[model samples]
Target: AQSVSQHNHHVILSEAASLELGCNYSYGGTVNLFWYVQYPGQHLQLLLKYFSGDPLVKGIKGFEAEFIKSKFSFNLRKPSVQWSDTAEYFCAVMPGYSSASKIIFGSGTRLSIRP
Candidate 1:
């Protein structure tokens, strides 16, 4: 079955730590990949996305993700993570470009940062 996978269930780090979160999908056709972050008491926000152009895309707050078509993966990365980066990250995939198409979200990865 087509699905998005996030292998990491939880991650712990201190301030100024680097982060890499893995995301992979099972769909065989073209797909739009996204990473959404939700702070402890805030709504989800779009961290980054990949559709048709260059596979590497940068998002807000120094966050970025690289889409690898061959591996069916779009992994999120941050050079240095701060306490503010602690949040629940979700990897989502849309099988097609249609706005009506439902986006499948991977099981979230919870990140905790020590002060």
Candidate 2:
């Protein structure tokens, strides 16, 4: 079965700290990767996504991810984080071959940034 893994369950950092949340998947075929953030009491918002074309894709809020096929990794990174970046971040994967493929989400990583 295909699945996603987020190594960090919770990450706490002060403002301006560099952030990198690990994400890996166990799929053998083509896949699309996504990073979604859900702020406190808010709906999930798309942070970044990687489908085709580029291995490195940038998303909203100065966030980006690199899709490394050799490692089955789609790690999210931000040079510096803010207190407002506090939220639950999820790493998701969907098979690219199928239009109806259900997205598999990792056990979220909760980010807490101190002001």
Candidate 3:
């Protein structure tokens, strides 16, 4: 079965700290990768996505992810984080198979920023 996994459940860091979260998937076919973020009270918004070309995708707020086909992974990274960056992080993927077509999210990572 096709599935996506996020290794981090919770991450606590100070302001301006570098951040990296692990993400891996098990799929042999085509797929669409995405990183969605829900800021404190904000709704889930697209951080980035990997559709066809370009393995390295960049999103808003200095967030970016690299889609490594060999590793079957797409990990999120940020050089510096802010207090406002605190939120829930979700790594998701949509397979190429034709079904109802749904976006599946990782349990989520709760990020806390301490000044």
Candidate 4:
């Protein structure tokens, strides 16, 4: 079965610190990768995504992710962290080569940033 995995269950850091969240997927075919963020009390928003062409994609708020097809990984990274960056990060994968494929989201990684 196709699935997404986020290695970090919870991450803690101070302001200005760097952040990296590991994500991996299980599938043998083409897929669309996405990183979604849900703030403390806000709805889930797309942070970044990788479909085709360039494997590297940059999203809003200085967030970026790299799609390494060989390892089936799409890790999220940020140069600096802020208190407002505290949120739940979810790595989602849409199996198949089409845009209408079903999306499977990872359990989630809760980020805590202290000022």
Candidate 5:
């Protein structure tokens, strides 16, 4: 089945440190891209997205990512991350193949921030 994968199962970072996450997917056609971040006990928020048009997209909380169509990859990056930025991150893709189609989530990267 088509799916997204988060290479990092866990990440540890100090305050004001850099963060780079690996994301990949297996799909045959057009799709929508997204990165969702879930803070402790908090709802998931859109970190970034790639619909159509440009391959590069910016997201909230000072996050950015580049979509490589050929590689079937969309990796999230942050030059410097805060303690609050530490959370589980997931990558999803909507193939638009079905109205009932659901977004597939990566296993998630549980990020920890240290002071």
Candidate 6:
């Protein structure tokens, strides 16, 4: 079975501050990685993803992630964060190429941005 781990449970930052959230998986074979963000009361939205091709993938809202195969990591990053970016970020993984595969999610990282 595959699992995702998010090291940071909560993160607080002021506007314009840089942000990075750690995410790791337990799978050793081909897998899919994704970052999803959920706002205060909104539905979960896809931030970024890495299936194949480039290891470095860019996402919406100035977000990006690097798929480090050797480290089994897909860390999310943003050069500068905004107050609107405040949300609960989740790291998810699905083993194999099947979109119907069960997607395992991390515990989630809550991000709070100061005005």
- The root-mean-square deviation over C-alpha atoms between each candidate and the true structure, in angstroms, is 1.2, 0.8, 1.3, 1.1, 1.2, 1.1
Flag clash pairs in model 6: none
lDDT for each candidate structure: 0.92, 0.95, 0.89, 0.93, 0.89, 0.94
Query: Once all C-alphas are superposed, what RMSD does model 1 give against the true structure?
Result: 1.2
Superior by lDDT: candidate 4 or candidate 6: 6
TM-score, cand. 5 vs. native: 0.93
Off by over 4 Å in 2: none
After superposition, the stretches of candidate 3 with alpha carbons farther than 4 Å from their true spots are none
TM-scores, all models, native as reference: 0.95, 0.97, 0.93, 0.95, 0.93, 0.95
Instruction: Please write out the lDDT profile of model 1 over residues 1-115, one tens digit for every residue.
Output: 6799999999999899899999999999889889999999999988888888998999999999999889988999998999999899999998884668688999999999999
Residue ranges of candidate 5 with Cα displaced over 4 Å: none
18-78: candidate 5 lDDT, tens digit per residue = 8889999999798888999899999988888898888889888789999998999999999
lDDT of 4 by residue, 14-81 (tens): 99999999999999998989999999989999998888989989999999999999999999999999
Clashing pairs in 2: none
Q: After superposition, how far is residue 45 of candidate 6 from its true place, in Å?
A: 1.3
Clash number for every model? 0, 0, 0, 0, 0, 0
Q: Candidate 1, which ten residues in sequence have the lowest lDDT sum?
A: 94-103
Q: Which ranges of candidate 6 are over 4 A from the true structure?
A: 97-99
**56: Cα error in model 4, Å:** 1.3
- lDDT (10s digit) by residue, model 2, range 19-65: 99999999999999999999999999889889898899999999999
lDDT of 6 by residue, 1-115 (tens): 6789999999999999999999999988899899999999999999988989999999998999999999999999999999999999999998985758788999999999998
